[model samples]
Target chain A: MQQIINFIIRNKNFLLFLLLFLLALVFTIQSHSYHKSKFVNSANFVSGGVYNSVNNISEYLHLKSQNQLLTEENNRLRNLLFNSNVNADSTFIDTTKFGLAYKFYSASIIKNSYTTKDNILLINKGEKDSIKQDYGVISSKGVIGIIDKTSNRFATVISILNTTNKISAQLKKSNHFGTLTWNGQNPATVQLIDIPVNAKVTVGDTIITSGRSSIFPKNIGIGVVKDFEKDVAENFYEINISLFNDMTNLEHVYIIENVHKQEINNLLDE
Target chain B: MNSSLILNISRFIMLVLAQVIIFNNVNFYGYINPYIYILFIAFFPVRDNRLTLIFVSFLIGLTIDMFLDSGGMHAAASVFIAYMRPLLLRWSFGTLYEHQTIRFTTIDFGPKISYLILLTFAHHLVLFTLEFFSISKTILILQKTLFCGIFTVILSIILSIIFSRKTK
Candidate 1:
């Protein structure tokens, strides 16, 4: 017993290092897996508050560009509203009167990272704002990511650029679906796999969400097919897509809540 | 002792902020960002308690991880380097380290540069390996380590020179 105690005391530094290293490794594994250890994340108050303050100063410097983006989005929305055909004799119908499928709340991105293999974004909204995990986040230009974790006043989004993130996407014209993933090489581009060779895809064809998942709604723009090649086995076509949103410079985004998600999930479970 | 403690605390805060807010967003060539924060561990006083250095390294690394949302990759790498720093110092400084007469500011340019390069590369290698965490990404891991290591070493050298007190 005396020898053991002496040995432990002598090697305390190594023992402490081993203990801390193992703890850190546990955090790394938890984060890599689908289920993250929540306490170690950035959605908490201290880190989130720091990001919020920094974003405020940077956001001020970006007012001109942000205003320009908002104006363009507004113009596009106005065109869609005024250009739609409505019969004069038909009674006006309110879409939200019956039930809304998805609810949208606007939020700003405080921190966005795309240079790493696993990227995450911090948004200004959280549980207090009704934001929750698995909610879909999108910019006006395209899909951004899915909310992964939320605190009282902040949330962390698993970006589409993350190698671990996979979204159900389809070719806009032909409705052929595949999995959208990132190669971790380029921030502006992502890859789609499992697209069949017979899908009749071409460069510049639009890609959109397939609505197969409960998070994002149908028909949200993702990107355009940039290039493609058949796998060696000739079974599937691997495609690269150029994103519409310059993810590196994002500011404003919308968090989407699927109202019927629980019902749909229950039905599928049966 | 008091002034050194204050200096280290301020350095910890400044490096964490500079890393997440400034360097994390630099995105040179769309993918490479220098991990300048490694300098915190690099410039830490050599005579401090090894256990405290290890703990401080883990704390700073975890703080950066929290802001960047990168889990504990930084913490693991920082701890590993802090543990190995004694050996690295011996290897780089030879007689100076053995005699406990080394001062970073007064070190020869060759040893100083080599030490920074070696430390940066080691940290980057461990960080990228744990981050990618797959055998298939060997090429990618090496690519990132090389590019990021070079950038980090360059920045660390420049910062050291700028911050170092006059030797004379």
Candidate 2:
């Protein structure tokens, strides 16, 4: 027993170093790669709840400012569509035969993260507000994200700027379509791939959502071409686009529910 | 003994709470996260085992990581600093640190200041490198580390002095 005790005492420092080094190695391996443990879901749920509560407090403080901004925006839009001299045909027509095609619900972003590869935004509106998975979300400037998950009072939106997110986009003038992706390099910029080299390109060309998908309406403003380069394949031109709305700065957004989404999905299922 | 232990626990809890709740969220234009939590590890009584000190640091860091949902970034960095601490002490004070317990204020100002600088640098290096794990953007990593490190190091040094003065 004495010898065993002495042995443990003598080897204690080495053992401690070994233990710490191993712990560090384990943490480094887990963090430096994408292999985050599955158990993190519980942590996310817990922290997410805390984050939600704190966000609610901050959002409450900002309610007056938010209301003021909304009022100003409402006035601007009202002046745009209901301009007193506008022709009746140009105005929003009440087609009695048409269904409620699009429903918009105002939502406040309760939690936001942009640094992760799969960034998600949690909003205050959810199932109770008719916010469902796959519903589209946008700020005043442009497209923000699509709903990925929902609870009774909260829904998570996978932002277009997320590394895993790809949406159909195109050059505004030419209508030549491409896929928009975040290169994970900068938040201000996103990459557009699959634009054929044959199409004319310039540094300042504007890009817009193609509306190829049923999620978003056509010609929504995305970004302007900040730079352009040829891809490794050389057959296509890859365009670097600078986004219009700063995704990090978003607060309140509109959740879009396409009335025809189910029909479109059913058709695509075939 | 019981009251001191409770006092230490409350102090540590308060430090962690303030650091995470206030400092971490304040971007200061994405340039600062004043990590005052290290002061808890720094001011731990001299008699505690080195291994225990390291373990405590790990626990603290892991708690922060859990809140941030950062997996283990803080834990890794904290452990790295903990591992290097003994070597840093030995180098800074030669054999004095090994033979005697360190009281920061009573120690010669030279050794104490140097000790603070070295440890602060070591901690910041590990934290920033782990936070930015990829070498693909080494320049950005360096920029962030240097800017945040300078501000945080200054704050930590000032806090340490205040702490030591009060205790004295």
Candidate 3:
């Protein structure tokens, strides 16, 4: 006991400094914006590089499953190319037939965060690759997010799972449009608001982007209606949609840029 | 002796007030920010309790950080210099540090300049590095550290000389 007290007295300054230093460090990290911290940037660089290498290895490991998926996609494309001509009235609207109003840019998701109220996904493409804010991003399965911000070599996306994100969507069966939003509770489920009570909606009905906004083209698959209930106003239906893409497992994504966005926006302004 | 302690405490408050309210707003160049508030940690009485010195330095730094919203950079740098003051004083003033309080006014001309410059430089370097927290902007970091250090060193020396007690 005597020795411990002597030691404390002897090096009290160092101990005090250490304690205060830790408090200051915690304050620093807690107060600093995640993007503002150069620590986060360097950490992103290091982690991005590591994830790239790990993805490369895992890509090799999952070759069989990936190849099967690719083959299935290829077969679907071939079918579309051949049968699309004969069955012009098919439910699927081949994008190639839609002129040059929309362009698709391929990007790989480097970081995905779905556990927060305002979750964001970081992609490898950025402004240098012609990506801009408000660009709609989707995977082969379904819609993922919209581009929020871009640096030189990277872009961040506001994911569909985010509470603040609202995408315009409609039912494929009834064509009744509503505002899609996330409840921040389930990654697999999102809610559609302002759907009029009169709309004929049933469980498992397909939901898709309405093309009302210039962000996404019409008929982009969103999900299936899982459940719905009357809102507080008793006029609109609060629909629950089960997302098709497992947001947590996304690896590759396609950014959709509507080239006519500005022209349409300008017309609306007038 | 009690008067001197009161004077030191008052000086600490005055310097912190000046730093946050006045000097912090003086953004001369794009990157150069003069941290003259570190004067409190730089010239604290040498024979004072080391633990008290560190705690006091922390309080001063924390006060400045709260005003500036700088996320504890000032506090971290202040504690660092407070801890290093003893070793730096022994290095700069040799035996003089062992016998007497390191008041800027009573110190010799040569040792005073060395002590002021070294501590000012150390404080500025740590402050800027923590504020930036990145190694990629090496040139920008060095540019900021050197310019701010030079500006702070000049201001601190001039202020200390002006405030130094007259020797008989």
Candidate 4:
């Protein structure tokens, strides 16, 4: 009994080290996917607030450009209203929510980086502005990215040019949708794969979001196909798309909150 | 136990805050982040027991891993450096190793500079390799190692020169 006690005393520090290491290792291994997602969510909640305040300062600096964009959009909307024929019986105009079918909240870019294995953008909008994961983000030029995480006043976005970003996009002419991915070699170009070999994929065909995504509305402009080829697999086609928006020069952006997102999510769950 | 002990703790806190809040966010050329936090562990007083030193190093790495979401790569690396530091220090400085306090500022200039540079390089090599996890991309790994190490060594030397008590 005494010998066992002595041995324990002598090895106490070593045992303590082993214990701490085991705890860390267990946390690494048993970190449940659900639990890890929760942790990431909370982290986003906290960091988002800090980013929003910092971005608010910059938003003040770019008020002029933003006003110009709003004016241009107003002019375009007025042009459409005057040209369309009125159907008095029905209030529905049958286009992208008709009266600005989506809510647009302006936010400034606080921290943005394009050169990484996974490119993430930090913007100054959060839960306070009704922003949530899966909302599509865009600048005046075109689609930017999708929100990945949200805090009270800030959110992180998965840029369209990120290697990890895969959104459903389709050819403008045929209504065929394929998976759009980035190759990480270039920021201006994104790769579209899984177009059926049968797709009438000619070079320079306009590509747009299929609206198959609950996050993004149908037919938002993404880019035009620059090049395409069949892979050795013979099952799918690889396409290069040239983006309309310059990701590197982004400043002001809008966060889109989809009204029917929860209903769609519940359906998917079921 | 001493003023140096209090100063060291404060430095540790400052280094960790700087790493998490500032340096981690800086991407000068995209992927060339400077890890100046490890300097806290590298310059711990030489008088500590080898076992205690290793444990402290492990804790340092664990703290970083938790924040950076690096799984276990940093933990594995820091423990290895802690284990090897004593042997490396003795071999590099010979009789100077017997001293209780490390007076890096007054030390023989050539050996002191070489020691700091070598250990800093060694730590970075272990870290980036485990991060990429392959013999492939050897060229990229070499590029990261040399540039980051040179940057870190320059910073550490500047710090040690200003702070080292031996210079007085």
Candidate 5:
């Protein structure tokens, strides 16, 4: 017993380091997975407030550009409104009832991270804003990410740039679908993997969300294919895509809620 | 003694704010991220308890990780470097490290630079490796470690030199 006690005393530093290192490893593993860990969620809960305050200041600094983008989006929406048939949806008295297919909620990114391997974005909207996990988020230019977790006043989006983030994307021309994933090499580009070799792929072909999962709607813009190559097995093609959105510089975004998602999922279950 | 405690607390807050608010946004060419926060672990009082240093370093890393949404990569890296600080100091300064504080102005130029460079490199190595967590990006990992390590080392040295008053 004395020898054992002395041994522990002798190696206390090493033991302490080992213990702390293991704890950190646990945290790393937890955060890497799709499920939100309590530690990370709470961390976001606290830091989200600080990020929102900081973003308030930075948001003011870029007001001119932000206003320009908003103006352009407004013009586009107005043009669509003028062209579309107002009589077609007489049952919909409220403008919010654009369609039963999807509902859009505007939210601004409070904190965005692009340099990390598994980048996550914090937005000002949260549970109170009717934001829920697995909802799709997009900016005016293209798809941004999926909501991973939500607090009372803030939420975190697992940015599409994350290595662990894989969405079903397809070529807009050929409809050949593949898994879109980031290579952790470039923020502006992503890789579409597992595409069959039989599919004809070309540079500059547009990619969009497949909507196989209820997370996002069909035809949301992803990017244009920059390059392509076959995988080691030669059975699949890996295509490089240059994203449309300048992910490093983003502000306003729309959170998409698929109204018929539960119905579609229920049908699948049956 | 009370003043020193207050000083350390303020330094902790200041460094974390600088790292999260300023340096994090400064993504130079999307590769080099200067981590001057390790300077806290480097400049910790020599006579302080190692356990306390480890805890503090872990907290510092966790704060950065939370802000950056990087899980625990920063926390693990910070703890790893904090644990290695004493051993590396002994290697660089031999017995001199035993009785003296590691303030940049007080330490000799040769050992100071060596210590700073080695620890910074080690911290970045662990951080990028854990961040990547795969052998496929070995080349990419090395590239980031080299560039980011050098950048952090240079920044840390400049800050140390600028802020460090020569011990009277």
Candidate 6:
């Protein structure tokens, strides 16, 4: 017993290092998996508050360009409104009002990272604002990412650029769909896999969310196909897509809440 | 002793902030942001209490992890480097480290630069490996380590020189 105590006392530093290193490894593993609440994240008050104030200054600097983007979006929406013909009749049934599947809330990005393999974004909205994990986040132009975790006043987004992020996306020209993933090589491009060779694919073809999942609505623009090649086995085509949203320069975004997600998930479990 | 303690505390805060707010956002060529926060572990005063250095290194790393939402990759790498620091110091400085009379500010440029470069590369290599966590990403991991290591070494040397001059 005396020798054991002395041994421990002598190697205390090594033991401490081994303990701390193992704890760190546990935290790393915990964070890599989905559906596990991470003990360490950026959604807490201190870091979130700092990022918020810094974002305020950056938001001011970006106002001019932000206004231009807003103006363009407004023009596009106005065009859609003007071009669609509306017939006023008491007997006409409005199908659009009956099926409001998604709700959107405006939020600004406080911190955005695209260079890392598993990038995450910190946004200004959180549980206090009714935001929750699994909520889909998007910009005026296109899809951004899904909410991964939420604190009281802030939330972290798993950016689509992250390697772990895989979204259901499909070609605009056909119903054929595949999984969207980032290659960790370029922030400007992501890869679409599991797309069958039978699908009519061509360069510049648009890809959008399939809405097969509860996270995002259907037809939300993702990117345009840049190039494609068949895999070594020739089973599926690995296609590269260039995103519409210049991810590095994003400021304002909208969070989407699927109103029937709970019902859908319950049904699936049965 | 108290003043140095205060200096270390402030240095920890400043380095963490500078890393997350300024350096993390740099995105040079979209991949080469230097992890200068390793500077804290690199320049911490040498003492017999290796345990203290390990604890401080873990704390600083965890703090950065919280800000970046990178889990514990930073903390793991920081602790690993902190544990390996003594060996690295002896290897770089040889008899100077043996005498226990070496001061970072007074150290010759050759050993100092080599130590900084080696430490930064070691830290970055561990960090990227944990981050990628795949054998397929070996090339990516090495590429990130080399690019980020060079940038970090240059920045660490410049910052140390500037601060050392202030102390003198």
DockQ of each: 0.74, 0.40, 0.16, 0.25, 0.62, 0.80
Cα RMSDs, all models: 2.0, 5.2, 19.1, 5.3, 2.6, 1.9
* Candidate 2 vs 6: which has more TM-score: 6
What CAPRI grade goes to candidate 3? incorrect
lDDT of 3 by residue, B94-115 (tens): 8877877555566788888788
Chain A only: TM-score per candidate: 0.95, 0.75, 0.76, 0.73, 0.89, 0.95
lDDT of 5 by residue, B23-135 (tens): 87878987578999999998888787888899899999988877777778889999999999888999989878776645545778788889999899999999989888889
Docking class of 2: acceptable
The order of the candidates by lDDT, greatest first, is: 6, 1, 5, 3, 2, 4
Candidate 2 local distance difference test against the native: 0.73
Clashes of each: 0, 0, 0, 1, 0, 0
Which candidate's lDDT is highest?
6
**Tens-digit lDDT string for candidate 6 (B35-119):** 9999999989986379999999999999999999888999999999999999999999999999899888789999999999889
Q: Candidate 6 has which clashing residue pairs, if any?
A: none
Question: What DockQ would candidate 4 receive versus the native complex?
Answer: 0.25
Comparing 2 with 4 on DockQ, the higher-scoring candidate is 2
Off by over 4 Å in 4: A1-103, A160-163, A183-189, A200-206, A224-227, A242-251, B16-30, B48-84, B87-91, B98-101, B129-139, B158-168
lDDT computed for candidate 4: 0.70
Worst 10 residues of 6 chain A by lDDT: A86-95
- Tens-place lDDT per residue, model 3, A1-270, is 999999998878788999998887766664444333322221133334543554565556556755665687679789889976576576987778776999999988765555434566668887789898889999877899888657676777778976668889999987789999986657889999999999998899999999999999998888998999999989999999999887766777899999999999999999
Candidate 3, residue A24: how far the Cα is off, in Å: 13
lDDT of 6 by residue, A183-228 (tens): 8889999999999999989999999999999999999999999999
What class would a CAPRI assessor give candidate 6's docking?
Answer: high
Cα lDDT for residue A205, candidate 3: 93
The residue-by-residue lDDT of candidate 4 on B1-168, one tens digit each, is: 588678677876777666755676666665567777777767777765656766777767766654454445566567666666776787678877766456554578677777777777877887776655458767767888898788778877776777675537
Worst 10 residues of 3 chain B by lDDT: B24-33
